[model samples]
Target: MEQNLQYFLIPFLNWEMMLLIWVGVFAGIWVGAIPGLSVTMAASLLISFTFSWDINSALALICGVFVGGVYGGSITAILLNIPGAPAAIATGIEGYPLAQRGEAGKAIGLCTTVSVFASFVGIIVLAVAAPVIANFSLKFAPRDFFLLAVMGILLIGSIGGGDPVKGITAGAIGILISMVGMDPSTGEMRYTFGNIYLMAGISFVTAMIGLFGVSEALTQFRQAGLKSPKQNLDRIIPSWATFVKYLPLSIRSSLLGVFIGALPGTGGDVAALLAYDQAKRSVRNPSRPFGTGAYEGIVAPETANKGAIGGAFIPMLTLGIPGDAVTAIIIGALYIHGLKPGPMLMIETPHLFWMIVSCLSISSIALLVLGLISVKPFAKIIEIPKEIIMPVVIILSVIGTYAIQNSVVDIFYMIGFGIIGYFMRLYGYATGPMVLGLILGPMLDANYRRTMQGAEDQFLPFLQGFVTSPISLFLTLAIVFLVFSQTAVYRRWRGIQ
Candidate 1:
């Protein structure tokens, strides 16, 4: 225990490590607030330049970036209706509406508070229950993962706005678009019509930038002369009563995020969406109706995504498995630094584990300070005139789309998606479902195929697996509950309305 204490204090004692962590957090916030500049990309780029740095220093920096980036993604989602990352998509559903109502400052303050609380929750879980959680997560099979994806698909009903039919249609279209690449199992071409770009599959990030950022800009152009909302920056921070009201929800969603993040191949995006759906269903007396600035909606997703930062590190430290893309890059960095990252990693280098926890702890504190300081400025952005801001949004969308791969073709694809999104919005179709579909489509397809192949393509065996495995059975039942909960009968029984 004394040795572990010493390990945890390493970063606190080392001025260089402390400075690097704060710098990384500051840089990560801006980077993550920009579309296409993902935390994963930032970490990967840092690895290239910091190849010669001490492993402790490099890991400290990466840890700070990981924590800060996840929180920063929500900033634009709130003020501009543009999610810097997919994890923040659910945040925009409620946050943007708040911004339109000129409550951006208050909304952001609450988000920052809950995000820090959730980050610590995830860290505590990582410190205490990481090995157990990592081992349990390994019990999840392909069938279970497919069922999880199916559960995610059911969220279209929750996030689909007022039109269920339109939402389903948009989601179906997104799934079709996701199928435009070569099959992973067999090298068979899918929807590619002899086009080289289509063969590589559509990047959801490009589609996201177009559908959210560009589509929002175009929609604003329709009401070009209308003045922007005058944001009220007073009382940015919530009261103790307000924080207490959301405490239970914050704990639940944060725990949910940590567990989901501990699962290999899943990350904050999935956790945030699931938390949003859960909050929509469970929160009885929200500050406002969902999709129009419910405080619960912001609390659930922001906390979940922030908690996911710590959850992501769980499997990486304990089992040598990456919980998300950023951790995967960190794994590579570990290798580059001549350190082995696997089951025996902790035993061999115990200080690395504790030091990371310390770095993340400090980073979360930095986020609290920095995030609150920026709330006023970010809220002022919502007060900008539509004519000026819309064009800037469009320009940023184009640049972000191109940065994905430096391909001009992606720009065209983005523009096309933007136009489609505009038409869909005109017709009352919610674009959230389509983005959700794009995000979960490949997971559903790949996992289902893997499960089927495991059963030798026998339909009976495949079906039986759902009942035979405990994990699969639980997930199947949860999916059933999710679908049933959407029915009017269920809503009536629960008196949800």
Candidate 2:
């Protein structure tokens, strides 16, 4: 395994792979700076153009963008309320608050430092631990996955920009939308309503584009071209002391990121939120309350979100299960190049796996350098006129979504989601629940069916399994907390007592 891992990571010292990685890095950064464009979208878009490329070169470029774009979303989320990607929502909770307070540059600096560092940790863990954990991860059958997805969806409460109802509502909407496509087991159409387009259901990327892109444009217009702070930022870097303070938390979050990323269906957004919640719980003094411009607020999610990059690859390489949507698409790319990802893949494609591991570490280093240099200038972008900024955000969002499949239908999907997202906000509904639900819905469906099948008509084992797993127990408690948070009695009791 040791010797084989090397073969995969260093298959060839070719210029093409290096160039493709660079291209992905650049494209990811650019795409991530805009609202609605996500790492998944960027990876999917690359799939179209790279049908003929060498497998190693394709992996290098695609993975580079995947890592970069996840980090890049924080750039806009910190500078503007318009999150560049869904995973940046948690960042926006603290980030936009800082931006509103005219500390956009400071927030950007802190986030950049953590993001790069966390990514480095995640990559290191992925490289070192893949062989050990890949098989363990596969132990998660459909039932386990379903329970895991439910646990992940519960995270919606914290991610709702501080509201539970809106998030849950949005999540319900997303689940319903995901249900539009044919039932995987039943082979029946539930929500297509005769349109072939609806048969494919609502893609999360399009919904995200609408929720972040269109809603943000309307929001900017509401500001009526309001002037923002004139950021005179230079030497915008986080202090070493700050990095030292977050080192422990960063490591913990990176671990969480890796595990969550390794899980099928869930991704960076979930990892970031989970890390943020853990940070809130673990920090006794907190330096300052989170969401109040605390450095911890910036570091926690930044680290976890980027750490998810490595976590996401673990399952993809060894188990042939795409950890998330982006990896799923990349899996397709791998097969297109005559490579398969599975248990046998380790024996047949060992070199491919190591190359990916190596690329992850290299990318993290690159992000650190690029992130430090770019964060200040990116934050300064808030100074652009709302009229100009809003329109550009919309255009980029449309292009980014459309770029994924070159489909005008996706642009329309984004528009629809935008309108829905605007109303959700107006009505005090959170988009967080919706996004989380959308992400977890398919996982939930697949796993639920599998668990039922495994039970052989007995429900007790299914219930027993839910109660037995350590991860499941912790997740169940989390779900309980989420549901309790929404209770009128809970709100009133707290208010009065």
- lDDT to native, each model: 0.91, 0.75
Score candidate 2 by TM-score against the native. 0.86
- Model 2 misplaced stretches (Cα beyond 4 Å): 1-20, 44-56, 161-163, 329-340, 347-350, 456-461, 468-497
Best by lDDT: 1
- Model 2 Cα lDDT, one tens digit per residue, 192-305: 888898887777767776886688677666667468777747547867887798799888887888887887777887788777766655565665667675666667888888
lDDT of 1 by residue, 263-376 (tens): 999999999999999999988778898988999999999999988989999999998999999999999999998889999999999999999899999999989998899889
